[model samples]
Target: MPTFADPFQQHQAEQLLQPVLIRVVDNLRKAMEASNWIGTYEEHLLWPEGTTTAEQEQVRQIAAQLEDADPEAAQHLQEQLSHLPMPFPGYELRLSQGEHTQRIDVWNLCYQVCFTHYDPDTPAEVDPHLLDEVGDVDWLALDEKAQQLVQVAFEQLGEGRKD
Candidate 1:
C-alpha cells in the first residue's frame, strides 16, 4: 500500500490504479454477462426493491378487495407478478486475465468502486476519471457505451412492466 504524503502523491497513486480499475469493472461485467446473470430470472422475487411495507399492505388490502369485487383482475395481477423478472442482485465479479482469475465478493467490489469515486472534503479535485484505463481513455466513447448498456437494461428489463 502506498501512503500519500500529499495531494500530488495521491494523484500519482490514482493514476497508477486507473488501468486496474477500468479492467476490473469491465472484466467483471463481461464475466457476469457470459455467466447468464442477466438472462435468468429468479422465481423467488415477488415485489422488487423500494416497495414499502405500507405499499405491500395496501396491495394486500386491494388484493382482498379485488378477490371479492373482481377475481379476474386479481388473477391478472398475480400472473404478472409471477412473470416479472427478478431485480438485479448484488452479483459476484469474476475477473479472468489469462491464467490469473480473481473472484471478488460483490459487496467488497462495490465498496472498492465506491471508495474510488469518493471525494474527500479537501480541496483536491482528483479529476474523477472514474474507471481509468491504460494510457488515455476516451471518456466520451465510454459515455455512449454506458448509455447503450443502460438502455439495454431498461429496454430488455422493460422497467418491471409498466403495464
Candidate 2:
C-alpha cells in the first residue's frame, strides 16, 4: 500500500474532497439568500460586507484548520433570498421598535440606530429625530433569486420540519 506522503494518495484525497467542498459552497449560498441584507448584484445575488463578511471569516477559519485536502471546504459561503423589492431605499427590510430601527445596508451591512435608546422595549413616544440619525438604508434583505436556493440549503443543513 502507498504511504500517506505518496503523490497518488494526495491526488485521491483531493478528489474525495470535491463533493464536500461543493456542499459547503451550496450551503453558504443558500444562507446568504435567507438573510435580511440584500445583495448588490441582481444576477448572482452576492453580498460582500457586514454579516456576510463575518460569516465568510468564520468559514475561512474553519477551512484553514481542516486538513490540506479540505483547506477550502468552507470557502465561498453565501445565500440568496429572493427578487422582492425592499421596503426602504437602499434597504430591503427594517426591524424596528418605536423610533429605533436597525437598518441593513446595500451589501447587508447592519447599522445600529441609537439616540433615545434603540432597545426594543423603548417607549413608542421616543423622539423621531433619533430615527433620522439612524440615516438612510441600503439593501435590507437578500435578493429574490436566492429564496429557493436558501430553502434547499436549509433542508440539507439538517433543519428538519417542525412536524
Candidate 3:
C-alpha cells in the first residue's frame, strides 16, 4: 500500500485523483440542479407567521401543478425536500490520515442556492449548520471500485521508498 510519508508521492496521488474528483463534483451539481424545486418548497416553509393561509395554499397548488406537469422532476424534488430544513449544496474537500489509510471527503454546504425559488429577491432564511446535513462524497463510504483506485494510488506512493 502507498504510504503518504513522502511529500512527492502524496502530491502525485492527489494529482491522480483530481479527474475523479471533478467527475464526482459535476455529477453532484447535475443532481442538485435536477432537484431544484426543493429550494422553493423550503422557502415557503420559512414564510413569516403573517403569511396568509391563501398564500400557503397557492404554494401547495404550485407544487401540485409541478407534480402533474413533471412527475419525474417533482419526484426528485420531493426526495430532496424529504430531507427538509437541511442546507443547500455547496462543494468542499477534506483530506485526513487514518490508521491504515488516507481519507478524502467531498462535502457539501448550503452556502450556494441549490434550487430555484419563487422569488429570487427573497431567499430562504436558514441556519448555516442545518445546511450541512449531507456529505456528497465520503472516501470511507465509497464503493469498492473507488476504494481500490484510491488504495492503488496510495500504494504507488510507497513504491521505491521505505517509511
The best candidate by lDDT is 1
Q: For model 2, how does the per-residue alpha-carbon lDDT over 41-119 read when each residue is reduced to its tens digit? A: 2222333333455555564554455434442442322211122221222333233333444322322211111112223
Question: Model 2 residue 78 lDDT?
Answer: 21
Judged by lDDT against the true structure, how good is candidate 3? 0.37
What digit string (tens of lDDT, one per residue) describes model 1 on residues 1-163? 2234478646644663454345445644554554434322122224555667776666666556666656677787776545433332344444444454444443333233323433333333233354356535445544444334433433442223222
Question: Considering every candidate listed, which one attains the maximal TM-score?
Answer: 1
Report the lDDT tens digits of candidate 3 across residue range 1-163: 1234357534534443443454444444443344211111111134444556775565565566666767788877676545433322333322223332322223212111121221334532322221223623333323333334434433443422223
The per-residue C-alpha lDDT of model 3 at residue 25 equals: 48
List TM-scores for all candidates, in order. 0.23, 0.20, 0.21
* Candidate no. 3 TM-score: 0.21
| True-structure Cα RMSD, model 2 | 23.2
Which ten residues in a row are the worst by lDDT in model 1?
A: 36-45
lDDT of 2: 0.32
